[model samples]
Target: MFATPAYAQAAGAAAPTGGMSFLIQMVPLIAIFVIFYFLLIRPQQQRMKKHRAMIDAARKGDQVVTGGGLVGKVTKVDDAFVEVEIAANVRVKVVKATLSDITPAGGARPAND
Candidate 1:
């Protein structure tokens, strides 16, 4: 076997290091997190907080709309559930978390009256 001798050559310049380099690598990730917090996480949290407060304050005679799309009047409100009258003489017990919208006593009346 015949092999040609090869000489060592200088390598290309290496990237710079230190805090600036670290920041340069992390800036995009940090920016993504910040963007997610403001555009997605923070708003969702605020909406959930508002929804929780509204659900916690629900009371009798309030017109409510369930996540299932049922519109009814809240005849009774418990710690974690509510008795909703979807129709005259027809009531169903539903979890409070399933209530998506709660209109105040004066907001609107149930369709069935």
Candidate 2:
């Protein structure tokens, strides 16, 4: 019944070429990782680099906007923080990295200026 047992044993033997089958199975997975790195990971890295350069270049008296939507003029720049004057005689300390946008180089416009 079910053919001779010897026939089944012969069919189960390993291939003469060794582990090439296992390597072939991994090719698709490796290709997917490469695609993800180029299409997603690389661009994110470049964007972060540009943002770091911008953050490092920040200086005092730059008109700026914060991530929280507060617009202010930078009064002082510290290694990791900034002093922003949001209103007349009203200054606040915030992290330098929270700055979102730099106003044009001429500084804020006064109501009469």
Candidate whose lDDT is highest:
1
After the best TM-score superposition of candidate 1, give how far the Cα of residue 15 lies from its true spot, in angstroms: 3.0
Question: CA lDDT of each candidate?
Answer: 0.92, 0.82
Tens digit of per-residue lDDT, candidate 1, span 23-88: 899999999999999999998898889889889999999999999999999999999999999999
lDDT of the structure predicted as candidate 2: 0.82
Error of 2 at 44 (Å): 0.6
1-113: candidate 2 lDDT, tens digit per residue: 78755544446666656588889888999999999999999989997777677777778878888999999988998999989999999999989888887664576533421
Reference-based lDDT, residue 49, model 1: 92
TM-scores for all candidates: the values are: 0.81, 0.73
Off by over 4 Å in 1: 1-9, 108-113
